[model samples]
Every structure is written in structure tokens, then in C-alpha cells.
Target: MSKKLRVAVIGCGAIAQRRHIPEYEVNENVELVAFADPVNERAQLYADKHNAKAYMDYEELLKEVEVDAVSVCTPNALHAPVAIAAAKAGAHVLVEKPMAVSTEEGTAMIEAARQNGVQLMVAHNQRYMPPHVKAKEILDSGRLGKVITFRTAFGHPGPEGWSVDGRNSWFFRKPEASMGAMGDLGVHKSDLIRHLLSDEVSEVGAFVGTIHKEGTDVDDNATCILRMRSGAIGTLTASWTYYKGGDNSTIIWCENGVLKIDTDPVDNVIVELTNGNVERYQVGAMATNEQQTHSGVVDAFVTHILEGTTPLVSGEEGLKSLQVILGAFESQATGKNVKLD
Candidate 1:
């Protein structure tokens, strides 16, 4: 058998514990080698569990350990610097969603990975969801005809309800998280819409506000209007006020029919044709904070590293999604439509 690739996880935060580390543990192509976090105890805990080395400083870990790849699960603000440093250290990077806090940061990280000849993938797991996969296949089959418009939403009570740090998590801090719902939740919908339509967002108009949640300088609710390159217009919303439960549903209106994804409790993907025909598919259940099954991110990242191929959610694709959210923020600030170049 081929030797397993050495993998290191930076940041023993909620995402690292729940998704990256767990997924990497199951991937046969990888061997978890090291764990790093600012909190030494957190890093040591995961390291002890996995029988790996632990370090409080990622820079020290990168310099000392010879890792083949690293997962950047730190807060949004640290995404760019840590990913760039990891690439420079000759390690492929699987960064969490939103890519970075800004377009400049995202671009810099991509350039660093390109310069280092290391693969860089974003953990945009929404595209890997079964319902989303089925939706993409149905749309590509021309059964939906030309997509006219769509609406997508990703909302939950708050990250505090899920994060290991609870109410005092970095997710609520503006400096560490940059933005709240838009950065944390909205970016997922933006990336998913782009993946489903295979088009870029050309323009955006948005309203972002702090309707709920206290002790934070970030927006808790955000709504945006997107104009796709294919001339399809849509609405995107992200909120932290969905106190009942998380709702990650999408509706697409096409010329021939409408496709609803993750909208029903029974059917994960539903397609209705103009000729009075309806198809319902029971794709796997949607992932939630309480019940997150294996997201294919770590496995795909390992596959690309082992095979020396590009990842599905490459850094460039991730940057596009990040730019859309940044454009929405600009739109919110200017109170006008912002165009993407």
C-alpha cells in the first residue's frame, strides 16, 4: 500500500473537532500527525486522543513537523495568514469556508499556494451534500430548462449554541470573525448557488443589520439580491434569529419547472414539471450542528493530495464565493447595487 500522507490540523476549535479532525481520522489516505491551537490544552487534548504531537503555535508546528497537508480551522481573520504560511511550508491546505475576511486576503492565499505548487481547497461542504448533488444533476440534465430565479437561506439560532466556547466564542467577536451571519452562514448559500447554476454573481444589493444577538458588533441578519452572470436573479438570506431550528432550504424556478432542495422533511430534493409531473427524491438528511455526518471535505482533500490533482472546491472557486459576500457588504454600506468584476 502507498504510504499515508501526513496531515496536521491547525486550530482545535469547534470546526476542527467536529468536522476536519473527525473526517481526517476516517480517511485511509491520511495519517493525522499534529494538532495546533493557541490554547495548549485544547491542542494537547486532541493530540492525546489521536496519538499526535501538539503545539500552541502553528508557526512552531509548521517549522518543526514535516506535514504533507494541513486543515485551517481557525477563525475567519486567521484564514489567510495561516493558509499562506502552510502553503509556504510545503503543505497543501484545506481551509474552512468564506476563504478569508476580504478579497485581498483570499487572493494572497491563492497566490501563495500557486507559488508553492500546493493544492488549496475550501471546505465548502454544502456542494458535497446529497440533495445538492442531485439538484445539480437534475439542473444539468435540462429537466429544469433555463433557471430563471432562485432563493436560498441558511439560518440557525447562533454559533454559541454549537461552538465549544459557547456564548463567548470567537464567532461573536468582530475582529476574529469579521462578520456574523453573512460571513458564517451566507457564504455557504452563495457558494452553493454558484455551484448549482455554474455561473458567477455579477451584482449584489443587500441589507445587513444586527436584529438579534447582543454583545456583538456584527450583523445577525443579512438579505441580498444577486444578479448572476447567466441573467438569473435571486435572493439570499442568512440569519441568526431562527430560534426554532436551523433551516437550510433552497427553491429554484426554471422555465420548465421548479426544484426545491432540502425544503421538506420527507423529500430532500423535489422537482415539479410544468406538465403536471412531480418527482421527489429522498436524498440523505441535511447536516446540522447537532447531527453532522461525514462531510466529504477531508476525504476529497486527501484524494487530491494523494493523486496530485486539483480539488473540486479550489481556492479560485472559493475566492469567487468570498467576493460575492464582500460585494454584498459593500452594497449594504453604499445602499446601492455593487458590481463584481
Candidate 2:
């Protein structure tokens, strides 16, 4: 058997603990080797639990250990720098979503990976889900016949309610992050709509509001309209105020039929044909890393490194989705349609 790839994880936060580490542990092609976090205790804890070395300084970890790949699980602001650093250290990179705070950062990370001749993949795990796979196959089958409209949403009570610590998390602070719903929840739907439709969003018009969570500097709710480059139109809504849950659903209307997937990733999907035919598919919820997003992404990355396969979610793919989210924020600010260049 080929040797297991040595993998290092930067930023041992809730995401690393919940998804990355556990997924890496189970993958036959990977051997978890090192961990780093600014918080020394968290790093130490993860190191002890995973039997890997830990460092508070990522550079220190990179310098001391030889790793085949690294996961940049740091805050949004640190993603680009860490990814660049990991690339320089001769490690392939797997960065968490939203890519970075700005397009420039995203571009820089991609360049670093290219210049270093290493693979760089963003964690857009939604594309790997069975339901999404089924949906994509259906859409590509021309069963959707020039899909004219696409709508997708992913929302919940808020990250604070789900994070390791409530109210004091970095997610609520702007310096540590950017738009709230736009980054936290909107990015998922943005990636999904683009992947399902297989088109780039050319323009966006949006409205963002902070109707709840007093004292938070970020918008908790966001809605937007999109015009695809292929002349398809769509709408996206992301929110953190859905106290009753049941978010993360999508509806697509095409010339031939309509397809709807309920909020839960694992559930019954409904499809309606223009000919008055309807079908239902029962899908079990998939285990997507820690946040139920995409553990398959981790496995895919490992396979890519071990066997020279292409990444399931490349940096370019992440940038396209980021474009949609950032365009939405731009539209929200300017109160007009923002064109994608």
C-alpha cells in the first residue's frame, strides 16, 4: 500500500475539531501530523487528542514539521496568508470557504499555490452531497430545459448559538470577519446555485438588514437577485433569524419542471413536471465534516494529493461563488444592481 499522506491542520477551532481532524483521522490516505492555533491551549488540546504536534505560531509548525498538505482553518482574514505560507512550505492547501475577505486575497492564495506547484482547494462541500449530485445530474440531463430561475437559501438561529462560545465569538466582530449572513450562510447558497446551474452570476441586486441580535455589527439577514451570464435569473436569501429552523432549501424552475429540496440535506425531495407529474426521493442526511457540510471534501483532497487527481472544489470555483456573495454585498451598499466584471 502507498504511504499515508502527512496532513497538518492550522487553526484548531470548532471547525477543525468538529470536522477536519475527525475526517482526516478516518481517511486511509491521510495521517494527521501537526496542528496550529493562536490559542495555545486549544492547540495543545487538539494535539493531545489527535497525537499530533501543536504550535501557537503556524510558521513555527511549518518550519519544524514536514507535511504533505495543510488545512487553513483560520479566520477569514488569515486565510490568504496562511494558505500562501503553507504553499511556500511545500504543502497542498485546503482553505475554509468564503476564500478570503476580498478578491485580491483570494487571487493571492491561488497564485501562491500555482507558483509553488501545489494544489489549493476551497472547502465548498455542498457540491459533494448526494442530493446535490442527483440535482446536478438532473439539471444537466436537460430535464430542466434552460433553467430560468434558481433560488437557494441556508440559514439558522446564528453561529453564536452554535459556536463553542456564545456572544464572544469572532463571528460577530467585523474586524475578525466581514458581512455576517453574507459570509456565514450566504456563501453556501451562492456556491450551490452556481454549481447547480453551472453558470456565472453576472449581476446582483441586494438588501441586507440587521433586524435582530442587538449590538451585533453585522447584518443578520440578506436577500438578493441575480442575473446569470447565461441569461438565467435567480434569487438568494440568507438569514440567521429563522428561530423555527427549517432553512437550507432550494427551488429551481425550468421549462420542463420544478425541483425542490427541503431544508434538511437528508430528507424527501420533491419534483414536479410540467405534464402534471410529480415524484419524491427520500435521501438520508449526509455527514458533511463538523457542520454537516462536507466530509467528502476532505476525502477528495486526500485522494487528489495521493493519486494526482483534480480537486473537487478548486480555488477558482470558490472565487466564482465568492463573487456572487461579494456582489450581493456591493448591491446592498449601493442600492443598485452591481455588475460582475
lDDT (C-alpha, whole model) for all candidates: 0.93, 0.83
Per-residue accuracy of model 1 over 208-276 as CA lDDT, tens digit each: 989879889889999999999999999999999899967899999999999999989999999999999
Highest lDDT against the true fold, candidate: 1
Candidate 2 lDDT over residue span 187-283, tens digit each: 8888888888888889999998888978888889999998988898988998988877547778899999998877444454677899999877776
Model 2, 137: alpha-carbon shift in Å?
Answer: 1.2
* Top candidate when judged by TM-score against the true structure: 1
Give per-model CA RMSD: 0.8, 1.9
For model 2 the local lDDT of residue 228 reads 88
Q: lDDT score, residue 292, model 1?
A: 91
Give stretches of model 1 more than 4 Å off.
none
